[model samples]
Target: MSVKPESASELFSGPFALGTFSAASGPAFPGLIDREGQVLDLRTALSDPALTMRGLLERWSAVLPQLRELASSSEPVRRPLEELRVLAPVEPRQIFQSGANYRQHVIDLHVAHRAPDDDRPEEERRAEAAEIMDRRAAEDLPYVFIGLPSSVTGPYDDVTLPAWAAKPDWELELVAVIGRPAHQVSVEEALEYVAGYTIANDLTDRATVFRRDMPQIGTDWLRSKNAPGFTPLGPWIVPAESIGDTGDLQLTLKLNGEVMQDESTKDMIFDVARMVAYASQTARLLPGDLVLTGSPAGNGMHWGRLLRDGDVMDASITGLGAQRTRCLAEES
Candidate 1:
């Protein structure tokens, strides 16, 4: 299904958003998407015809005004959005993913995936999980992990479920795109470093999440999450200024017309600012880098319903565009 501007405008509040689009056989170019469903080719509009989305983000502060003016004007060079193929918004040099950061998501997971040998009451397990979450939120740091840029794909691209992946799952998350260089920044200043926001479906192979052979090593995120096209990111990037409140945005994911996950950013144990700040304490955040806030409750695992071949996932975040990904099983 094609993305309609009228439908997109309901969720995306921005006057315009940055996206990467390409003709049938042409190379991708940076473009500005207006609310009226028109795309202004930034290649010809900007001074540099070769400017990429990442390059635009590097000069985001300086170029923002120009983009805003262009979006408001009747730019003759604009084309119908549906005429072009939308690609991932930006090619990030780094990707930082937060794990188990949502309050109810963790609580639900603890209850749903309880040890087979532990015959405890549901209420007792829930209370214990809630206490653990509360204490972690108060004391421990956010669990952040590295993800490969190679795993990134276009919002509407097909995801190949590897043959070895017995159980694949979907994790819809809100991604913060960095504009400025941030090193050891405080939580209060972290938002200032964020240029915009986008959506990402962090697909995972549940079977590889744990290392049964080496239990001491804990979770094996690399094997579970970093497959090619595992991360379907962006229909577009909404400027941070346009997104009023990051804390209250709703995140919803539908699997094959069924609402599998529906929750709000308010359920996050650590907000975007805290997660970004926590990431910067160890590594420098550069332009176009992505910091994915953890997924909320109602994942496939929680429902005991995992992804199958030919499944379609529609993920959306408030003020950020939506992404529709189709799943295909790998050939033997």
Candidate 2:
């Protein structure tokens, strides 16, 4: 733990999906680890035979043939049965994120911030000091957030809105994962430390957010951000190397397959270079660390329609894959 780990390879050193991927000896794509467990050993299922760390490090994205070959004859580092008990792969740390990284989100939140008296009453106003922190800090890209690691539900997992959230909204965000240690990096060369991309929904409590009369309140995004199973990530992460370029990608949000929001990464107020450079200027970005760019438009708030218990939402980004979630509202 004292010395820098020279042996670690960004691709192989996972916050992996846990189960064996279909192409074990090749790249591991993210997927829902069904409660019943199926197609879990993707790595072992690959045609390639050498399903070890050496194979993965050297082969990164080579797509060698026979990569999907079953590894029934091979030995696993851990006992097979023991592996099944392991929970789904998730980041060990809070997934870091930025607020208003996108142009539309900034304009949207800005309007909300300038509204009249808060819908919440006097006592409730004092209580939600956490939510108000966002209004003041809603300036631009490089806004950081410490996400709920436990809140990470798989791509197809159920997203539940607490009974108290009157306006549960979905915000589609593209998340960047840090592959290497980047401290005080320059925007000119920040891409070197990136590992890959994934999808994140910055779901918020809109009812409390757009209150027209009051000043913004609260440090806790707890009410507005951290709803149960609110954060959905995975489907799979495209290796940063595979991504080629971070800008100019298409981002979209849909409800039951109907497009509600369509925007391009080019609209991002701060590009990846500026974002990574700014974040690293003061804080250290470690492996598995996430830099969540803020969401684009087409959220429920813009319509005044809130997420209901049975509503389904999809957050998709080009190359990053889409995460589909079913909303669950706590009922009395």
Candidate 3:
């Protein structure tokens, strides 16, 4: 149930972007998508039929110049973009997801999920949440968790809403694609390690977020978020250099053509640099690893309208790209 957008070029920005595409049910290959809606097969262009998008990122420095020159010239082997099936731009080995990184989003969660017995006024609750967020931003470290790479699916692929998932939700995020090796890198140098940017919808089963059976164990991110096709990632990756300010990117998610989440990256309590640096402190950030900056203010929990069968989600990040995913109920 893949729904192709009206124009693929409108979803991406810049003169060119990188992606993975397949033709006539053939094996996927690295593709260079130009603004003219043409795809130049990187496998043929680079004389490596087995090249993957992650493989290109591993040698991004050496490959980028060649890509630029190839994009500029008239290539004889290019194909029409509409004739191919787009896949996830890169297959990441590690996915680091930041949690509660958005200021208003955390505040909304705090206010919405308060104890039923608590009778505090809404304004007071919101104010208390804001103060807590401020204190955390000023003093505490970012909250990050590991996500499975196996959960990733193509941007336009259908997402199965598991029958047990009583409350499925969408949390569209801006993902930073790593190019350079980073271990215990400083916040100042974190951005330099980013190769490019892409969009990811961090789908969650809100019902399984907390483990009632093991309260002391706290949140169960694996059960809540690691289902297959839980993360629909990338129409393509836009070079970080092409996007000057990571702080001001706009993230928008529309459910059935109605905008549910529309917020700016400026609201992030822990920015991309901080999240990346924090993750690098514990693990080696390699090329093709993804650092997902937390989602913004509007989510299904905030609006009290969760996902259903046949619901379509149209998610996009500024200059990065858009992903259109359809929801289907899992058969019993």
Candidate 4:
């Protein structure tokens, strides 16, 4: 299928295609994807034998200009997107996830799980939660947690439902891929360090999110979120320049073809720049580091429906790309 390239003015910033491609000639290796949904062997394009996607990110300041020219230059030897295997854009060195960033999503969660002993009107509870969120955004810092890089998997890969996770859930997030080394950056300049944006389904085990014995320590992200294939990421990394308003994009997810999560990034209590800036205050973000800007509600936990074997998730973020993942049970 021939995909017409977006117009020159409509092109994604640097709009470089970065992913692993597999063809009949050999196994999968990292390459550049073009506007027409085709792959460009990076070695042939950059004329550098050591330029992998991660390498490109590490040198993004130098490579972006070249990519901009390459994207518009005469068509090079290309391979159809469907004919090759698409892997994760890059194996990120660090993964940071923002929690409770979506105002409405968090409010809905609190309202839904109100204490049974306290009899309060839903309307009053919702209003109170909204006030708290607004206060948090104004005065409190965002809640961020670390995730294991090993949990990463391809966008098209199957997600293994861990045997211990009885209530596997999905959280479709907008991932900001860092292109520059950032330490103590301001919100105004945070986007400058971002290479691109991609899709991430932050799969969680709802049953393990909290600990009765260790409530003081708070959520146990390691066990609740970081299992092999727990983070299914990428079909493409759309350059940040190509994206217009970071907070206005639509994020959607379907379970078995039914819309389970459909919301706009505008609902976030803290926007992308804030999330990046906040994460940077604690850690030096290097190229290829991923900061997931939380999901916009409609999670499985809210719907009273959790993932099961044979379930398929179709996740997409406006302009970034879409991903389809099938669920399978983990063998003991």
**Each prediction's Cα lDDT score?**
0.89, 0.58, 0.91, 0.84
The number of the candidate with the highest lDDT is 3
Worst 10 residues of 3 by lDDT: 5-14
User: lDDT for model 2, on a 0 to 1 scale?
Assistant: 0.58
Q: Residue-wise lDDT of candidate 4 within 1-332, one digit each (tens)?
A: 11211221122334555676667677556676776666777767888765667888999888888878777776578676767767787889999999999988899878866766968998999999999898998896899999999999988888899999988999999999999999999999999999989889999997888775877886789999999999998877787888857878898999998999999999998999999999999899999999999998899878999999888898888887688889998889
**Model 2: per-residue Cα lDDT over 130-161, one tens digit each:** 34444543654356657767666656667778
Cα error of candidate 4 at position 68, Å? 1.5
Error of 3 at 239 (Å): 0.7
- Model 3, position 196, has a per-residue lDDT of 92
Better structure of 1 and 3 per lDDT: 3
Tens digits of per-residue lDDT for model 1, 203-241: 988789889899789899999999999999999899999
Best of the candidates, TM-score:
3
Off by over 4 Å in 1: 1-11
- TM-score of decoy 1: 0.96
How big is the positional error of residue 58 in model 1, measured in Å on the Cα after superposition? Answer: 0.8
